[model samples]
Target: MDWTALWLSMRLAAWTVAILLPISVLMGRFLAYRQFRAKGMVEALVMLPLVLPPTVFGFYLLVAFGRNSPVGDLWQGLFGHQLVFSFEGLVVASVIFNLPFAVQPAQRGFEAIPVEVREAASCCGMSPLASLWKVELPLAWPGLMTAMVLTFAHTLGEFGIVLMVGGSIPGETKTIAISIYDKVQGFDDRSAGIMSAVLVAISLFTIALTYWLSARMGRRLS
Candidate 1:
């Protein structure tokens, strides 16, 4: 068992979830409430990753984050290091790759809120921000949990994007999925099986727990 790789995957998933939570909430709320031009286009763009091939998406990200690109150059100049093959790079890639998993559920949750409830919140003198923090969030808690779990699990299993962006740098960018691949390629079937089993168990538990909790919460609410 590669403890370093296991820890790194956990850290990456945790960081991705942390960064995405507030962003998902804001974007979800905006999409839920706003009627704007190209709304369908905007949604399609947000959802593109879900349908796009991971390697193809990763190839573009590789070019965009390579040393020659403006954003890449700026980051290197300021931070004194390139972003590629780094843990930070993995986090960024994971966040982008798993964004829809976090945002779509949250958006649906927000949309599920009744118009009457929002109107009542306004009538009770709650500002939009206040209502979001108090009323909207409470009602949408289950969806938010689903978003976080999905993102975490998705990040845990990422291979293509993380590999393209971060490469396999142990203790830095090598995640469990990559580690499993490496082990298998090296004919280390026992190690690969162990890691693969761990991933499967974790994913199964998270998905099962998420649905169970959602069902329990629904029953309570009803």
Candidate 2:
């Protein structure tokens, strides 16, 4: 197995979760509590990545972040390097691509909060921020945890977008998934098999843990 690549994938997953967690919380809480125009449209946009093919999404991202594009140019000016084919580019792509996974569960969790509970929080003179931290987050822990796990797992497994945006540069952007592809292309079945098995094990563990948390914490909340 490519240890370096495996490490890179973990790093990428960590960065994605760290970046996406708060965004998911804020957006998910808003969508859960607020009603406004084009709400369905906004929710649909968030869910778009779930159905969109990875390669297609990656292609659009490639163009959007390419050297000639405004985003790319601005990033280049600010960072002194092209955005595409870099590790930072991969993290940005992973966060965007994993939006639904992180947001949907969080939204559900926030929505599950009882109106009376919130009213009571306000009655007790808790600020919105304090209510979010002390009341809402504890109640919504399971969903938030699920979102974080899903984002981390998806980032580890993501292939097409990672490849398109951040090409296989070892120790930089060559994540484990890309490393597995490289191993296979090079006819190194043994290494590929090892890497695939590792991923499968991690995925199973995360998924099962998600279900467990949802069940156990969900029951306590009830």
Candidate 3:
């Protein structure tokens, strides 16, 4: 097995989760508690990555963040390197692509919190932030855990966007999925098989955890 690629994939997943967690919490809470116009449209935009073809999404990301693009130029000016084919680029792409996975469950978690509970927190002189940290989060942890687990596992197995945007730079952008593909292309079946099995195991665990969390959340809400 290409341990380096595995490590790189893990690192990328971690970064993606770290960057998305707070954003997920905020966005999820907003979507859960608020009734606003065009909410469905907002949700559709978030879910777009899940449905969109990875190759098409990656092409858009490449064009939007390429050296000639404004965002790319700005990043290059500050970072002294191009965003495309870099680890940072992969992190950014992963975060965007995994938005629905992270946000949707968090929304469900936050939605599980009863309005009366939030009102009671406020009546007890709790600030919005305090209510969120002390009252809301505890009640919604299972859903949030499901979100993070899904995001982490999905990030590990994601191949198209990473390949398109970051390429196969060893120890940099060559994630486990890409490594498996490379091994297969090189006719290294043993290595590919090992990595594939590892990913399959991770995916199974993720799904199991998600189901358990969903059940717990349902019971809590019920």
- Give the best candidate by TM-score: 1
- Candidate 1, residues 12-34, lDDT tens digits: the string is 99999999999899888889888
lDDT of 1 at 34: 87
TM-score preference between candidates 2 and 3, better one = 2
- Whichever of 1 and 3 has more TM-score, that candidate is 1
Q: What is the C-alpha lDDT of each candidate?
A: 0.91, 0.93, 0.94
Relative to the true structure, candidate 3 has a C-alpha RMSD (angstroms) of 2.1
Writing each residue's lDDT as its tens digit, candidate 3 over 43-68 gives 99999999999999999999999989
RMSD of every prediction: 1.2, 1.4, 2.1
Residue 18 accuracy (lDDT) in model 1: 99
Rank by lDDT, descending? 3, 2, 1
* lDDT score of residue 190 within candidate 2: 100
